[model samples]
Structure formats: C-alpha cells, structure tokens
Target: MKITFLGTGTGIPQDGRVQSGVLLDTGKNLLLFDCGCGVLGRIHESGYEHKDIDAIIITHLHLDHVGDILALIKANWLLGKTDMRIYGPQGTKEWFEKTLDVYDYLRDRFTVEITELSPEEEFIPQGTEGNCNCNIRSAKTAHTDNSLAYRIESSHKTVVYTGDTEPCQEVMELAEDADVLIHECSFPLGFPMTNHTTPDLLTLMMDEYPLTAKKLYLTHLYPQMQGRYREATDHIRKYYKGEVIIAKDLMVVEIQDD
Candidate 1:
C-alpha cells in the first residue's frame, strides 16, 4: 500500500499546504480520504487523473475536509468516469443530496453513491480485476459529534488515518499495532485548544495510553504549526519511541517490507 499526503494543512491556508486530504494506493485501487478545499487541484498537480480515484472516505463534514468533493466528482465526469462511492458519517447522504440539489447542472451530470458509515463498521470496497483484497474500518473520533478515523489494511501492512481529532482513546485503540498511524497534530505545544491536538496534549495522553504503531506521521497542520514542526515531532519523540514525521504534501509512504 502507498499512502500519499496530498494536502496537510487545515481550513486555514498556508504557503506550502492546502487542506486536509490523503490518497492510498494498494496497487489495486485508489482510496481517497478527506477531499478538502484544494484537493482536486492537488490531485491534478500530483499527476494523477481525478477519475483514477475508486472511492472517497470522508472523516467529517468540516469544510476543510469536504469542500472540494463536488469538484472531484465533476472532474471524474469530464474524464468519462461517472461512478463514485463515498463513505462518510451520518448526514453524509443528506449532505451530498442537498449539495447536489443546489447545482442544477451537476445533479444529472454524474452519478455518485454515498454510504453512511458508523464507528467500528468495516467493509471492503469493490475493486477492478487483478486488484489485491483490501478492507477499511472506521472508529469514532472525538473531534466532533460524528468524526471518524479510518484504518486501511491491504496485503499485510495497516495504515491508520485520523481525520481531525483530539487525542482520544477510541482512535488510539483503533490504531493499535498498525504499521503507520497518520494522525492530526493541529497545533504546537502549549496551545490551548479543543477538538484538535497539540504536541503537549498528545504526549500527555500518550503517557497514559501509549500508541503501539511502528511509526507516527503527523498531518492536518494549522498555520500555528509553522516553524514548529521539528519541535512538535521532538516533543512526541520523548514519549513515543517510534518514527515521527511531520507530513508534507506529495509525500508518499509505501507499506511494504522495509
């Protein structure tokens, strides 16, 4: 499996970052997570066609996460690919329906199937011929009332992608023993915040509930994290003895034997 960090920033824009989005490739299918504001453009910039995405799993309904979903679907239609399966928390179906209702031209331009998922639900997306068997599971995240974190396991390695969450036990438990945990560290140390994480808050929680993943990559950064990436990783390093990296756009990780 290959996980690509398409956009690592949050709602607030930064110079090098766009918004919250990631892509996972199992050499069989492409699974996109959280198509935020600039994600469609980033997909094009990353040299991948928009129609290549097999499915999209959204973590929440936050604008930074779901902003460009329409654009993605539209682009796929332009490329003669009209099928899309979207998995998201409750209200997802309604959200898409309502969004489409507003755009008269888009309502009939393409067809998209939206599935509402609950925490702990797991399913395998339909794949084309000669693709590896892959499965995805979701766990409730504490960022919002309906936020979810996802774990995708294909071939052998597992990769956990936390949408936008505070340091919560449910997400940590869901991520246990995974090869890579891609979590959101939105703020720097000593920043008082809620519904999001800081380096101090994460380590403080890690003191009680340790993360067992082989590596941790932090994404969904805010402008506040600017110039503090190394410090954030160093702080978490003291508590979690694993690879900790601050994810950048276009960074790719291959989940194969190292």
Candidate 2:
C-alpha cells in the first residue's frame, strides 16, 4: 500500500500546506481520505488523476475535511468518470444532499453512492473500477460526535488514519501494532486547545497507551505549528521508540507488507 499526503494543513491558511486530504494506493485501487479545499489540485500535482479515485472515506463533516467533495466529483464528471462511492460518518447522506441542493445543475448528473458509517462498522472497498480486496474498520474519535478514525488493511500492511482528534482510547485501539499511524497534531507543545492535539497531549498517552505503530506521521497542521516541528517530534521521541514524521503536502509513504 502506498500513502500520499495530499494536503496537510488545517482550516487556517499556511505556506506549503493545504487542508486535509490523503490518498492510499493499495496497489489495485486508490482510496482517498478527506477532500478538503485544495486537495483537487494536489491530486493532480501528485501525479494522480481525480477520475481514478475509487472510493472516498471521510473522517468528519468539518469544512476543512470535506470542502472539496463536490468539486472532486464535478471534476470526475467532467472527465466522463461519474461513478463513485463515498463513505463517511453518520449525517453524511444529509450533508451531501444539502450541499448538492444548492447546485441543481449537477444534482442528478452522476452516480454517487454515499454510505453513512457508524463506529466499528466494517466494510470492503472495491475500488471504483478495479478489484481491491482491502478491509476497512473505523472507530469513533474524540473530535466530533460523528468523527471517525479509520484502520485500513491490505496484504498484512495496516495503516491507521486519525482524522482530527485529541488523545483517545478508541483511536489507540484502532492503531494497535499498525505499520503507520497518520495522526493529527494541530498545535505545538504547551498550546492550550481542545478537540485538537499537541505534542504534550499526544505524549501523555505514550506513558500508558504506548503507541504501537512503527511509524507515526503527524498531519492536519495549523499555522501555529510552523516553527515547532522539531520540538514536537522531540517531545514524542522522549517516550516513544518510533519514527515521528511531520507530514507535508505531496509527501508519499509506501507501506510494505511484512
């Protein structure tokens, strides 16, 4: 499985970083997670076509996490590729309907299957036009009531993506012994915030939870974390014995099977 960080920034604007988006190419299919504002262009910049996205897995309903859903679908429509399956937390169906209501011209132009997922729901995503035998499971996150963190497994390679959450037991359980954990670190250490993460808050879990991923890539960065990358990684390194990475736009991670 190959992972590409499409956009790593948050709602706040920052240089070299856009809102949340990630692409997981599991050899046979391309699975997209979170299609924020600038992700459409990043998809092209990363050398992948928007029309090839088989399924979209969204983590939450926040604008920063779902701003480009319509745009992406429209882009695919223009390319004559209209079939897509989108999965998200509860209320996703309503959200898509409400958003499409404003644009009547494109309302019935394509085939979009939206599935609302609850915590612990398991499903198999058969890539839009290919056969990808991958299992996906989600857990409720701590950010929003319907927010979810996904664990994707294919060929013994597992990757956990924590959309945007504070330290939570559900996410820890979902990421146990995974190859990589693409978590969110929205702020720097010592930054007072709720419903988000900082280095201090994440490290607090290491003492007890003990992050089991071999690699931890922190995404969903805010502008406030511009100058604190080293400090944040240093803090996590103090307790965890794994690679800590600050995800950037267009960054790629190839997941190899054991």
Clashes of each: 0, 1
> C-alpha displacement of 64 in model 1, angstroms?
0.5
lDDT of 2 by residue, 31-150 (tens): 999999999999999999999889999999999999998999999999898788999999999999999999989977898888899999999975755556799999999899999999
Question: Candidate 1 has which clashing residue pairs, if any?
Answer: none
lDDT of model number 1:
0.89
Badly placed stretches (over 4 Å) of model 2 are none
Error of 2 at 130 (Å): 6.4
Best by lDDT: 2
- What TM-score number comes out for model 2? 0.98
Alpha-carbon error at 26 in model 1, in Å?
Answer: 0.3
TM-scores for the candidates: 0.97, 0.98
Compare the candidates by TM-score and give the number of the best one. Answer: 2
lDDT of 1 at 85: 83
Model 2 score (lDDT)? 0.92
